[model samples]
Target: MSNWSIDAGVICFSGVLDRFTVPDLWASLSSWKPTEKGYLVDLSRVERVDSAGMVMLIHLLEHAKTENCHIMLSFVPKDLGTLFRLSNVDKLLAKHIQN
Candidate 1:
């Protein structure tokens, strides 16, 4: 199972980020709007992620960008980072790096 929490302008994710969970994350993010401080998605607690998960993450970032919302990813796990690199999506991911 997977879950997320929204607090202090940050979205914290936990558990596996697979096909099943990606959609749920998408649904949750639909209601998110960036504040002046922007938004951050904390991935420190994310246990795993699949290709679909990665795609969904990209989609979320694209959605945010189109809306002119300032959002980023934080504490990205090594595995996900590698996936991003291998998939040649690291460039897009870089635009949303927390630090």
Candidate 2:
């Protein structure tokens, strides 16, 4: 299972973020709205991620766009970054990635 929390305006995620966990995480974030200055998504504690997790992150970015907000991803895992590159979405998500 995966878990996420918003603390100090940052969304922190932990545990595996695979197909099984993305759904619940997505549902839990339905009501989330980024602040005017945007939001930071911290994934440092996330142990694993798969395609589904990538899709969910993309969807979250899309959702933020609709609200005229920006979402920045931070502390991305190496595997997840590799997946993004392999999926050819690195460019699309590049602006949102933060070191």
Best by TM-score: 2
Candidate 1 — which pairs collide? none
Candidate 2 residue-wise lDDT, 1-99, digit = tens: 899988776889999999999888999777787766688999999999999999899998899898898889999999999999999999999999998
lDDT, candidate 1, 13-97, per-residue tens: 8999999888878787767665535678899999999887788778777777777777789998888888899999898678798
TM-score on alpha carbons, each prediction: 0.85, 0.93
TM-score of 2: 0.93
Cα shift from native, residue 59, model 2 (Å) = 0.6
TM-score quality measure for candidate 1: 0.85
RMSD (CA, Å), each prediction: 1.8, 1.1
How many clashing residue pairs, candidate 1? 0
